[model samples]
Target chain A: MMVPVRCFTCGNVVGEHWEEFDERSNEGDEDPEAVLDELGVDRYCCRRMLVSHTDLVDVVSPYQ
Target chain B: MSEEYDVEFVEREDREARFLVRGVTPAFANGIRRAMVADVPTMAIDTVRFIENSSVMFDEQIALRLGLVPLTTPPEGEFVEDDTVTLSIDVEGPDTAYSGDLVSNDELVQPADENVPIIDLKDGQRLEAEADAVIERGKNHAKHQGGVGVGYRHLQRVEVVDDLPEFEEQESQIVRGVIEEDGELVSTTEFDHDLSKRYPGKEVRLEDVPNAFVFHVETDGSFTIEELVTRAADTIEARATELEDAVQL
Candidate 1:
């Protein structure tokens, strides 16, 4: 996953919540907002980090 | 400047707190903010050595993640910048790696929040690394910031010019100030910023208290909110002492 260690805009640590966010978002059982709120990420900037991230690590690792 | 100030707690949580400091200058309030953000020292992973990695994340990325993990600061006079606390993590998993996985040499110097995830590993994927925690100030790097969301706003003064029927209906909802039935405004009321927004364009006007400040501080679990504020005040005092020494010299 292309998760950043901290939110670029607000500097809140967001990477820690990415795994759970990714899992629930994929499950489609709960809205992203509810998941984010449960994760204690209330700011819009931190919220955007989880919503827009793509897992590119798997795609690029083979080249290394 | 010698006037005594009143500190009233507005809200208190484990990691966040809000308080009102009356009878302080704006400069003094700002000094607290700057000190909390830059002067207070905290423990953070500063260096990492990789032993094995079959995961998708690069070694540098893993190290960066480790460095960002907030560590609990050792008691005052217990931390030494040159002294490094070792942290090692080894996991073979079809599961997620967490900050709790990293074991520290010192019990007092470990991850402040254990739930921080480092990486997700699939079956057959392995990751191993050793990290060093060191004490540092936030001015050097954000990873060492003792606290976050350290800020203050001037306390506001609300006055009612003409209490109309519309204003009277919303008066009960306003906790900061009491709107008497005869439209008299009380100055001793508590201040709440939301009150102004709840009733916009009413006969009320909000004014700023130049000397009164409402401060909010949020920690990253590195230290208690009380510790952060106390350290900030200590930092300000140290700076002032240095300035006095310089003038004497």
Candidate 2:
């Protein structure tokens, strides 16, 4: 229901950088690629973890 | 075999570093790499007790998330394997719970990063829990791995051999790891890992510098690079001493 604490593939801690990534890329006008680059997320696997996360907790939590 | 071992840092940062270790056999280098990855202990949530949960996710799922959140590990001798630090979190609905919300009883063992989201609470939903983080080695659980990425390679030197023959097709010669050229160390990535790009229309010979290795290590923020390396080395030394004592008996 949240961004995983680590990248599923490489186990790098991507969760620590999620709020910055989201705020800069989604909420602000920065490109996702630039944001990830600035965050030092070099590997494609770790990049995908941040790019593809949906943050479904809000969608699913209402049902409970 | 009396050569003294030497170490030099190529790149150093809080969580990641690259360094050259000279006068070590391949086996010794590998031992250091393995020790860094699996021997050094870090604190991770090992037990969780929920006070209330109206969120959609199951308790087990949230617990797993909490377990993976990297916690700041105190220096060696501050904690033993079974020692646990208590942390608790409570958040009301219309808000998202994050690692920062987890209040630690021990200040030194707090979460490494505050932005790691644990869960999102919808309107009226709540998440409250207390977790016990225990010191453990990576061999016990992946969550306890402080050195998330630990690896090394033999230091290679590139020597110019000869110019390419007239009209000879120049093929891409890709090399990985750090390379020494003219008494200077350069990462292969500086030239895109292509020998051709570095020395166009020229032949180059690659030679491994005996007993030298370049190690690249990245941690999970639980500990600094210096602490991780020193702790890993200490672990190896301790094990060797234990073996020696056993043999003497």
Leading candidate by DockQ: 2
Model 2 residue pairs with clashes: none
- Stretches of model 1 off by over 4 angstroms after superposition: A58-64, B165-202
lDDT of 1: 0.79
In order of appearance, the predictions have TM-scores of: 0.85, 0.94
Estimate, for each residue in B71-106, the C-alpha lDDT of model 2 and write its tens digit. 999988999978999999999988989988999999
Q: Backbone collision count in every prediction? A: 0, 0
- What lDDT is reached at residue B247 by model 2? 98
Model 2: share of real contacts kept: 0.77
lDDT of each: 0.79, 0.90
The superposed Cα distance between candidate 2 and the true structure at residue B83, in angstroms, equals: 1.3
In model 2, which regions exceed 4 Å deviation?
Answer: A22-31
